[model samples]
Target chain A: MNAVIFNGPRKIDVEKRPKPTLRDPTDAIVKVTSAGICGSELHMYRGHQKTATGHIMGHEFVGFIEEVGSDVRSFQVGQKVVCTFSPVCMCCWFCEHGYSNRCPEGLAPFGTQGLAGGQAEYVRVPFADGTLKSTPEGVDDELLIMMCDIFPTGHYGAMRAIECFRSSDLVNGNHYTDLDSPKRSGLSKSQSLEEAVFVCLGCGPVGLCAILTARSKGVRTIYVVDSVDDRLDQAAKLGGIPLKLGRDDVQAKVMKATQGRGADAVIEVVGNNAALRSAFDLLRPCGVLSSIGFHQGDLPFTALECYQKNLNINLGRAPVRTVFDEAMEVVAANKEKLASMVTHRLPLSKAAYGYEIFEKQLARKVILVP
Target chain B: MNAVIFNGPRKIDVEKRPKPTLRDPTDAIVKVTSAGICGSELHMYRGHQKTATGHIMGHEFVGFIEEVGSDVRSFQVGQKVVCTFSPVCMCCWFCEHGYSNRCPEGLAPFGTQGLAGGQAEYVRVPFADGTLKSTPEGVDDELLIMMCDIFPTGHYGAMRAIECFRSSDLVNGNHYTDLDSPKRSGLSKSQSLEEAVFVCLGCGPVGLCAILTARSKGVRTIYVVDSVDDRLDQAAKLGGIPLKLGRDDVQAKVMKATQGRGADAVIEVVGNNAALRSAFDLLRPCGVLSSIGFHQGDLPFTALECYQKNLNINLGRAPVRTVFDEAMEVVAANKEKLASMVTHRLPLSKAAYGYEIFEKQLARKVILVP
Candidate 1:
């Protein structure tokens, strides 16, 4: 099996690896159908998070169930599925309560010497009953890849961002705006985001898919912020307001567009304290700072600013299990045109090239076809 | 009437002042029966927080309703009542939402020479409908003083603290408690203590009240910590396990008592960030850290700590409206036994002496009888 392996800083290679097996009674071995190279892959590649060298580098994918343990049920061999970055035990309270990302039986490649990640020919998924969501019949491979991780992550951002704006008010004092006000034009039972504007930072596939999910929610004006001109062009092609990063006064532009208020919500998919602060500033008071970025350090937001503006702050890794199905429904419904998010598709033997493209910031959702 | 006016830091003196008149249709003139000294009063005495110089200093009191506003209907002339520190409009959203303490119209005093506080002989309570609660039939003046403020704040600490502990087993993390595991004995609803050990720092009424309320709540071990030995003794007389501050590892002692599990809750009645941090660290993973103290500036505890340990951290100015009835009920039920929490009673003319004694930490609860 061909796998993408992280060697050292900025280094990735296509390496021959053994296919995985069901290591537990509840495990399933999935033949990788499509996996996406992630920015975090590059981070690991460069040893930024110092994940060990030669760690099979990707953790985002959709695949086919090649084998299942004796205890597996409802899911049969050869069934198509999307697996989250981390496996969880659905029976655990954390999983039942929508915190599957923090599942007690979390199984991920935690170190450099960790097992081969999803960007390989096959991967063993532990806690198969809880971690694997079967792709609906006839869902395409490209779209199913999203249900595996990034798309659900983006959708989770959207859902939690809306939740954030609803609970915080007056406390975010100077930051509240009526566009996001639940007391005002909030989504009714019959209404969804039909004409909302979303500002996404880092125009990766996750960002682009956030745009897609935003449109499905009825959002009309989507703003994409990134330093790369190519990503900005991709944003414009996808019907987004492409605001060049570092040059755009995003808050000024957003407020001006919303008549000096602010966007309904800003999905800060980029982590770290700076992006966290930017999301707060870009939001109208009561706006939500929906962060999906994995920063393990202190966020530097002037908390008083959020408190005074009554901005809502949300954290954690993606709540993937809960939104995986909904994301699939939206993607399957929009089938014919969703492939644009996968900019580079390569054979499993070209896994190194996929990593290189993402590392060079030249691709959005590079798909690895095994 | 003779009032001991707080002129400035170290500047209280006996002065002749006119009795308050009904300045607004919603205002009431109270013939103050007894005004209690407060921990916040020290903020004025030490010149940390400002107030109008020569203005009445107390913000805690029980008094007779000498007069009512034209719109006031809940009380009749000559009814004994306890007045909250700030004036609140009952119909406002804040009052309606039950956070009357942060009422929109209420005055927040700073340096001396600001609005009237409660220390004077004739204090005018504006917005009588929201600010004053009439004593039930014959509740004595000393007992009513608590319903004025601190006791509810302490109870808020006790209740909010017990709620934040996410799970008792996480601090050890995978070594003992696995996620979703059954809760253990110490935090069980049936847990017992000979005297619930509550290490309360600051021995002021808020701390002392926490000791007493914990006792009332069936907390078997009550540990009170404060710099003043006298205040520690005050907690001891009220059935507390007093630990003199600067003389003990309060957290070590608390953990020692709970068999290495921390105290159920650590109420930081003193508002310093250091105390808040100490309270947070002293807790068993599931222990609650309740801040009744009005904190200023950035709090130091890492948000990650709370999330990882499933710790609950709640900070707010005291929410007095919700707990008023509960506190008053306790006071009324134990009026005779409650008198011990009070230490000094003085005439309005000696309000200066009351402030003096409180500033030097000589009085626990000083009441100015007008």
Candidate 2:
């Protein structure tokens, strides 16, 4: 099988590698239909993260189950499926408590940690019964691939920001009883997202997806910030108000647009100190800062700043499984709008080129079809 | 009039000062009946915080309305009242949103910023209708003064931790409707504190008050961590399992007690990096780190650490107003247990001596009576 592998810093290559096999009864062998080049993968490509030479790369994939372990009762051969980045055992303490992202027996999705990359002929998936969801009939490969990572992740970020704001509202009112209803999911009916302003930092695929999710959720005022002109242009084309990272004074622009107040919620998809600081500065008092970026070091803002602003800082990996079903509904409803985000597509053998263009910020999303 | 002034670093003195009068239509002259020396005041006393030489000091006070401004229609002269540390207008955006702690028109209670200290013959309170709460009939000065700061602040800390935990639970479950019930206050009836293990990081007056509040609210396993033997003794006396800071391996102790699961919630009252780190270490995955300590610099933990642990870090000033009424009820019900926390009392003229003893950690709480 031809697979993408990490060669060295700033290096990636597609080379012949041994095909994956079912190693455990709970595992399933998947024939890759499509895979995504995630922004987090760029961290390893640039040596910002540790990765061994010849390490297979890619975590997001849509595929067909070629073989299923005996223990995997929910899945069978030849079924189209999409799997989350983290393979979780549904019965683990963390998973049962709704924190599948931190599942004790969790395995990193297809590419890293000695797992064969999904940008290949085939890949092996563990905890197949819990991690892999059958692709809904007739959904396009582009949309299904998104369910594997970016879409649910972006939705999780937006939902967290909105929920934080709602929690504050609960604190201010006597409507504590409202929290019991499932209807209070992300954006409630009474609380229109159209009335709140959302700021997305880093117009990468995740950020763009966040903008799309916010729009589909009825957020009217969406500001997308990024250094890349092409990404900003794409954001503008998708009903977002684009702000150039260095050229536009984002804080000043957001404050001006909000009539001297800051944004109601900020989805920080770029996990760096400057972006975190900007997100903090762009929020109104008691606003929520939902951080989805894969951050390495300490949070940039001081405890004093967070306290003085009365900020609610929620930090964690997105439990994609929690929002996967709902995100699929949104994607299925707005397939055309979301399909526009996949700007580049290539054969699995050309994954090296995909990494090159994506790393340089030359494409919104690069889909590798195997 | 006589008042306690911040003469300089490590210096406090009772000096003759002009008696305050109505400064605005919403102002009221409060004849301070009692004021408590707070742990935070020790920060200014030890020169950790900048304080002007003539700045009046004291933020927790209970008093009688000596004179009411014309616009202050809620209270008449001789009405007993208690004021929170921040004099909020209640009409500001923050106040209306239930974040009176960050009120834009907020003034430091009693002292700093030209507001006269409550440890004086008379203090002028602005935003009288909003900031001053009428003292409930039969509530003693000791219990009422507790409401002025430590008690509510401690409750605020515990509530933030519990609320953060509750909010995380909502994220994991389908109980969005549960948030609407007032019964979903801080500690839900279904999610009793009795089942959760709580760790209070400091044994100051506020931390001790937090233990009492937690106990009154049905928390069965409460662990109080502090360095001072006397403070730890007091905590033990109040039905807490006291752990001396340096003598005990705090994290190991907590983990051993919880069967290696760590604490369910940690109320951090000591606002420093080491204490913050300890609080973080004592929490199990997906736990809440509620900070009530007045932290100065950046959070010690990295964003990656918080993310990996799935931590919900709630930082901010205590919205004392939001919980003042509720706290009053708790205080009235547990007056005897709480009054035991006040170890020393002195006349207003002896405030200088009170500050000396309190600053030296020789007393748990010092009440200065006018």
Candidate 3:
């Protein structure tokens, strides 16, 4: 089978790899149908992440089950399915609690955990019963593939941003009167998202998707910030108030827009320290900064600043599988707007070119068809 | 009037100062009946915090209103009251939303903002309507003074720790059916504090008070860590399993006690980076690290580590006013145990000796009566 392999810093190539086979009874073999190159993948391709030569390099894939181990009950051979980037067992403490992203065995992406990548013709998926989701009827391949990672991830970021307001409401005694009623939800029902002002940093695919999710949730004013003109243009096209990163002082602009008040919530999709700092600066007192970016090293903001602002900094990997079903509904309903995210598509043999185009920021999203 | 003034590093003196006059329409002149020396005051005493040579020191005081400005409504002259360490204007956005600690004009801890401190014959308090709480009957001076800062601060830490669990439940779907019912409290009614395992780092007055607050909340197993024998003894007397810091590997002991699972929640009351790191290390995955300690610099844990463990790092100054009434109830109920925290009492003229003894760790708490 042909696959994309990491060959060293700033180098990748198409190479022949042996086909994958199910090694566990709960495992199943998936025939690669479609996969999306992610921003995180760019980290390894640019040598920001340490990767050994010939590492199979894809985590977002939607495919058909070609073979199933005997114990795999929920899935069978020849069924169309979409797999989460992180495969979960569904029984671990984290999985049971909807934090499958932190699952012990589930942390492994398709290519990085001694498992082959879906960029190949065949890949063995462990914990098949829990990890694979059947493609819902009426959802196209692009949307299904997105459900594998970025779409749900973006949705998770937006949800957490909204949750910040809900938490504020909880503490302020604005809502939640009954402590005994099992029917009571923690967040305020009367607080409409239509009143929230959201700021999205980075304007990459994930950032753009976050703007889309915030819009769907009825967020009123959405500000998207990015350095790339193309990305910012794309964000504007999708109804975001696009702001060029270097040209505009984002903090001043946001403060002006909010009438000297900061944003109600900030979606920090850029993982760097500067972006984190901007997100912190953009939030009002008691506002939430939902960080979906894959950050490395220490936190950008000091403990003193966090305390003074009374900020709720919710940082982590998105529990993609937990919100997969809900995200699919949103994606299915807005298929055209979301599908527009896929500006470039190519055969798996041209995976190297796709990586180059993505690395240079020449395309919005590049999907590889196997 | 006499007040304890910050002369220089490791130097303090009781000096004569002009009697405070009501400066604002909402200001009140408080004749401080009793004031407790706080751990944070030590920061200014040791020159860790930059302070003016003659700046007044104390922030925790229970007093009688000697005089009230024309606009003061709720507070009356001769009414017994307690003031929060951070005076807040309750009408501000942060205070209105239960984040009084972040109020713009509220960060003024009686002494720091050109406002006189309560460790004097009389202190002028700003935003009297919002900052001063009328004493409820049956509460002692010691308990009321504690409510000024440490008691509510401790309660705030415990509340944040429990909130971590509630947030986990919210995402896991173990509880809360409605995401918007508004009738739901932030925490789970069914979950008993009797089942929670709490670990408190630092055995200072605040740490000891936190242990008391956790106990009042019905927490069954509490581990208190400190190096001082007297402090540890006090913790043991307060129903905590006291662990001396240098004699034991605190992490190992806690892990063993929790059956290889780390503490469900950790209260970091010591404000250093090492203590913060230990608190992070001692928590189970998804556990809450509620830091009430005034930390100076950056966080010790990396963002990647926080993400991997799914940690809720709730760091902030306690919103003392918001929880003042609730803490008063707790302190009043546990007066005996709470008052025992005050091991020494001195006249305001002996403020220098009080600071010396408390700085040397000779007393658990020192109360200066003016």
Candidate 4:
């Protein structure tokens, strides 16, 4: 099997590696169908996070199960499936609570698992019964590929921001939102959910997904912030109002749009220091702030701003499996229109060029077929 | 009327201020019955917070309705009442949402309203109808003083922690939880809850109140942490297992008590960086970490640990109105014994001395009488 391996910083090579096999009883060997280059992969490529040499790098993949171990009962050979970045055993406490990504006995579904990735011809899925989910009959690799993580990550980020927004005592009376409250705006009957705007930082695919997610749920005004003009244009094409980052007074512009209320919810999808800080500055009193941006280093923040604003500061990984179904429904609803997001698609042999274009932010989402 | 005022750091002096008359049409003048010297007073006394010289220095008080402006209609003159520190207008956007504290048109009961402290002969309360609560027939100053903040802070902390604990997916079968579920040794369901230990960091009145509040809910194995031995001893007398800060390994102790599973919920009453960090450290995977502590400064936390441990981080100011009823209920249930938390009593004439003791963290609840 030919796999993309990370040798060191700024290094990538396509080399022949042994095809993966089902080593554990709960494991399933998946033949690569389609995979997408991820933002996290760039971290490894940049040496932000240490990745070992000769490691099979990708985790975002959709595939057909080519072989199943003896104990694998939920899947069979040749079944089409999508799995998340992390694999969890369904029996683990975390999995039972809908956090399949944090299963104690789970394995990282990438090169770290000592198995070749879907970037190759085959990959082994640990805890297949719990981690792998079959796509609906008509969903293709192009659509189902999102089930792996991106769509859910974006959806979870938006949902968490909504959670924080609903928590504003200024908006909902008190910050103690009943997890039992309807997942959207946990407003009591007395509290009205009238007009609100969401400002999404970063014009990546995830940010676009968030714009779609927020708009689908009734928000008419959506602001997308990004430095790159082309990316901003892409966001605009995807039904978002784009604003140039750093060049524009995003805080004042958003505040003006919200009638001096600031943004009702600020989602920082870009993990830069300025983006995180701006996320807080762009919020209204009791505004919701959530981020899915992965930062490599520490940044300064103010609890006073968080408290005086009476914010419900929530931080955690995106609950992928929890939001996967809703995300699929969303994509399915906007299928033909959102298809433009996949600007470039190439065979696995051209993976190197796909990654190069993505790094320069020249291509939005580069899908590689196997 | 004479009141304790903050002139400078450690320079508190009694000011012969003019008697407060009704300024707002909705205001009520209360003949201060009993005022409690609070830890928050230190925020002003040490110049940590902005305080006007000759300004009244207290927010915690129980009093009687001596007079009311023309628009006041809720209570009659001569009625005993407990004033809430955070006032709600009942009609404001935040008030309607149940966050009377952040009421857009509301005012803070003390320094916020540009008045002298409640540590005086009389205090004026604006938005009187919603801010002042009449004492239930026989409730004395000892009970009434609590409604101002600390008791409700504890109850809010307890309820918030409960909500976080229940919502967290840190169980054996949950993905993030089971990965590090403290039950490295197989423990049954009966053992887990039976061995549930609760830890309250900082045995200040607020911390003690949280210990009492959680205990009031029948939580087993309560541990109280404080740097002062006297406070810890008081906590022990209040039925808590006391652990001296820095002197004791609170996390290890709680883990041992729960058979290596950290406390089910760790309520942080002291908002200092050390206590806040310890509170996070003291929790087992899926543990609920709530801070009611008035963290005066910034406390940077490691996000990866919080995510990897699957911590449910909840930080907020006391939602006074939301849990006022529960606090009263909890207090009423254990009234006979819990009132012992009030450690000292001093007349309003000695308000300066009272502030001195409170600044030193020497008193639990020092009640001031006219």
Candidate 5:
């Protein structure tokens, strides 16, 4: 079987590998039909996050079950399914409560930590009954592959950004055109979902997914920020008002648009200190910073700053399996817009080029056919 | 008028000062009947948080409206009322949305930042209609005084601690005695509020109030941690299982109690790095750390740590005026248990002694009769 392997820093190779087989009664052997190169994968590809010299490299995949172990009751051979980045046990308390990412079974993302990636022709999926979701009818392989990781993650960020307001009575059809109080408009009111302003701090694939999810959920305006013009243009095409990070006074523009009150929520998908600082600066007094970024450093701001702003930070990995079905609905609703997100589709032999173009910001979404 | 004045670090004095007057049309002059020394005040009292010498030094008070400005429509002269720690504009977007603590008008807590303290013969309250609450019928001055800050703050902490679980479908009358996973009990399941385990990381006035609030809200067991034997005894008396810091293996005890799942929530009232570390260590996955402590330092953990634990940190000042009525109910339900929290009652002239004993941990709560 051919697979994309991580060779070292800025190194990826397409090489022949042994086919995977079910290791446990609950495992399934899946033949990969379509897989994606995630933005998170760039961290390992660039050696920012260490990966073994020769490890399989992909967590986003849609595959058909080639064989199922006897204990895999929910799935059968020849079933088309989407796989979550990490598998989880179905019975644990965390899993039962919709926090499957933190399942005591441990989060071992496919392609890392000795787990073979689905970029290969065949891959072993453990806990198949709990981790694999059937591809929804009418959803293409491109969209189903996204549901495995990025789409659900983006949807998760959007859900968390609005969860605080969703439960409030104030969320009921209240609209305010003017947010600036005693200074500008002399009238101020709380914003409902339609009236609330959001800022997406990156225009990467996940950021675009978040923008799409937010739009689908009734968010009217999203100010998307990024350094790359191409990504910002893509964001603009998705109905977001683009703001370049350095040239554009992003803070001033967002503040002016919001009538001096910052965004009600800032979805931070870029896992860096600068993006975090921007998110903090671009929030209203009681704003939510829903971050799905895989950060490696300490938070840029102090506890005192969070307190002064009355900030509510809801961050972590998306519980993919928990939100997988809901994310599929998001993808199904905006299939055409999401389909355009696929800028590159290549054979498994060109996986290294896919990684190269993705790292250089020339590709939005790249798919691999094994 | 006589008032408690901050002289410097560890220096407190009762001095004669000019009587306060209405500075704005929304102001009201309240004659202080009772004022309590709040745990947060110790920060400025001990010079951990610097304050100008001679500033009045208390924020928790219940008093009678001695005079009301023409614009103060909701309050009138001679009406008994409880004052929140900070003043907020009634008309701001934040105030209307239950985030009055971060009202765009600014958060000016009484007794700091040049605002006159309630520990005086008289005090002036700005935004009276929004900042002052009518004392509940049959509630004593002691309990109402606590409602000004400590009680509501404690209730806010408890509410945030259980909020994640409160909204969960898994909170529906489920009881699970064993949470140990594939390793130990092998019968892990989510515990409902009545069956969930909680740990309060302090037993000061606010911490004890949180324990009481958690109990009133159907939390069956709380393990309260404090080094002071006196505070621990008070916690035990309030139905909390006491764990002494440094003397007891707090983590071991909590893990044992929850069958290795740790606390469902950790109410962090102690504002320090050690307490934060302990809170992180004691929490189960997806646990809530409702921190109301006035922290001056950076967070003890990194973003990766927060992500790894799937931590949901709800930390900030409590929106006192927003939760005032609800906190009054908490006080009214647990009046006797709360009453015992006040260990020192002194006249206004003995303010120095109150500050001294409170800083030494010899006082659980102190109220001043002006």
Candidate 6:
């Protein structure tokens, strides 16, 4: 089986690796049809995150189940499915409590440790019943692939920001939409959602998805900040008000847009100190900052800064398995946008090119067909 | 009027200061009958917080409305009322949005800036209708005074933790209490609240109030951490499982008590990096950390730590005015316990002694009669 292997820093190689087989009864072998070269992968490609040599390099993929272990009751061979970035045990306290992202028994992001990833032609998916979700009928492979990771993550960040705001005293006098009822999901009786201003820092794939998610959830104004002009243009195409970093006065634009109140919510997808600082500065009192970035640095703001701003910070990896269904609904709702999100599609042999374009931020999203 | 003035570090003096008079159309001059030395005041007393010489030293008080300005329609002269620690302008965006604690127009804690402290014979309260709540007819001045800051602060910490938990997917399958309705505010349909474990760092006034508040809200097990045995004993008396820092293996105890799940929630009232570090180490994945402490230090945890733990942190000053009515109900329900909370009562002339005992953790709470 041919696979994209992590050789070293800024190194990639297409090599013939042994085909994966089910290690546990709950495991299944997924023949990867389509996989994404994520922005997170850039962290490893750029040597930001340590990666072992010969490790498979993708966590987002959509394909058919080539084989299923006897214990895998929910899926069968030939079933079309999407795999979550990390596998969950499904019965751990965190998994039972709907926080599968932190499942103590198993939350290893695929392609790391002993778990090989989906960039290969065949990959073993442990806890298949918990990790794999069937693609909705009629959805394209690329659109369903988006639901595998970044889309759900972006959706979760946006959803969490809105949820935090909805449960706050900020919405006390204002009529707001209830997310539980799909028929009445967005702004309805009140224009508060339309009036509420949001900010998304970074215009990467996940940030673009956050913008789309915010729009679908009835947020009328989203000030998207990014350094790259191409990414900012993509955000603007998705209806986000783009603020180019170091070029535009980001804080002034957000404050002006929000009537000097700052943003009601900020979805921070850029996992750096500067982005976190901007998030703190661009939020109003009692504002929610939902950070979905895979940050490695210490928090930029002091405890006093958080208190004075009365900040509510909800941050973590998206529980992809938990929010899969809802994210699919969002994906289904914005199928066209998701389709356009894929800027480049390449064969498994062209994985190096995919990595290069993605690392340079020249491509919005690159899909590799195996 | 005689008042407790901040002279210098560890130097408190009872001095004759001019009696405060109504200064604005919404101001009211209160004849302070009782004022309590709070944990927050100790910060300024110890010079941790900058305090000007001759600054009056208390923010918690129960008094009679001696005089009301023309715009103070809700508060009448001679009405018994409890004044919030900080006065909030009723018309600010934060005040209208339910975050009166961060009211940009007027969140200066009384005793700071131009606002005279309440530890005097008379104190002027701006936004009288917004800051003062009428005391329950039969409640003791001391118990109602508790509602001014610490009690509501503790209650807010507990409530915010519970609210954050309730609105999460953790309570999806489990039946939980609804906070809006007084009748259904605690555990009812399920025993999850009883099974849930909470941790409170620091067993001073606010931490003690947190224990009582958690118990009142049907949280059966709370591990209260403190270095002082006296404070731990007070927490034990209020149904908390006391954990003495340095004396006990705090992390081991919490892990054992929670089946290695850490704490379901952590109410951090100690305004230091150590307490914040303890909070991060003691919380389970997706646990809520409600910090009502006035911390000046940078956050102890890194963004990676927060992300890895999937933490939800709600930190700020308690909006005493916003939660005034609810806290009064908590106060009314636990009046007997609250009565025992005030371990020392001193005359205005003995303010120095009161500050000494309270600063040394010899007193659970100190009330000064003016």
Best by lDDT: 6
Best by TM-score: 3
- In candidate 6, how many Å is residue B366 off? 1.4
Model 1, A1-370: lDDT tens digits are 8877777877777788788777888989988878877665565665556655767767777888999999988579988888877777877544543455656667453223545588778888877887888767887777777776777777766555543333232221111123123232211111134444567776776776676666665567778888888777876776778998778887789988865656667887765567766776776543445666666555465323333443334555565765565667678777765667677888878877777777777776788887
What are the per-model numbers of colliding residue pairs?
39, 17, 0, 22, 0, 0
TM-score of each: 0.68, 0.92, 0.93, 0.86, 0.92, 0.93
What's model 6's overall lDDT?
A: 0.82
Q: Give the TM-score of chain A, superposed on the true chain A, for all candidates in the order listed.
A: 0.86, 0.92, 0.95, 0.90, 0.92, 0.92
lDDT of 4 at A173: 23
Worst ten in a row by lDDT for model 6 chain A? A182-191
* Model 4 per-residue lDDT tens digits across residues A126-183: 8788778888877777777766777777776776665445334322323333322324
Ranking by lDDT, best first?
6, 5, 3, 2, 4, 1
lDDT of 5 at B359: 92
- Please write out the lDDT profile of model 6 over residues B1-370, one tens digit for every residue: 8998889889989999888876789999999999999989888889898857878878999999999999988988899999889888867767766777777756578887567789999998888888888888889877877888998898888778766765565222221122222122221122266778899998888898888888987789899999999889889999999998888999999999888988988999999888988999999988889898889879888888998988889888887777776677778877787778888888999999999998988788899998
Candidate 2 residue-wise lDDT, A190-298, digit = tens: 3336778889898887887788777766688989999999888878877899999779999899999877768888999987878888899999876778888988887
Quality class of the docking in candidate 3, CAPRI style:
acceptable
Error of 3 at B344 (Å): 1.4
1 or 2: which has the higher DockQ?
A: 2
lDDT of 6 by residue, A1-370 (tens): 9999999888889999999887899899999999988888787898887756788989999999999999999987899999998888777677666777787646578877567888889999998998899888999877877887898898888878876765565222222123222122221122266778899999898998889988987788899999999888889988999899889999999888878989999999988788988898999888889999988878889888987877889878888777777678778877776677888989999999999988887888999999
DockQ of each: 0.08, 0.45, 0.40, 0.25, 0.31, 0.43
For model 4, the local distance difference test gives 0.70
Q: Per-residue lDDT of A181-261 in model 5, one digit per residue for the tens?
A: 211121234456888899999889899888988887778889999999988988898889999977999999999988797
Models sorted by TM-score, best on top = 3, 6, 2, 5, 4, 1
Which whole-number lDDT from 0 to 100 does residue B210 have in model 5? 88
Sort all candidates by DockQ, best to worst: 2, 6, 3, 5, 4, 1
Model 5 chain B is weakest, by summed lDDT over 10 consecutive residues, at B175-184
Q: Distance from true position, residue A358, model 4, in Å? A: 1.5
Query: How accurately is candidate 6 docked according to DockQ?
Result: 0.43
Interface RMS for model 3? 4.5
lDDT (Cα, 0-100) at B44 in candidate 2: 79
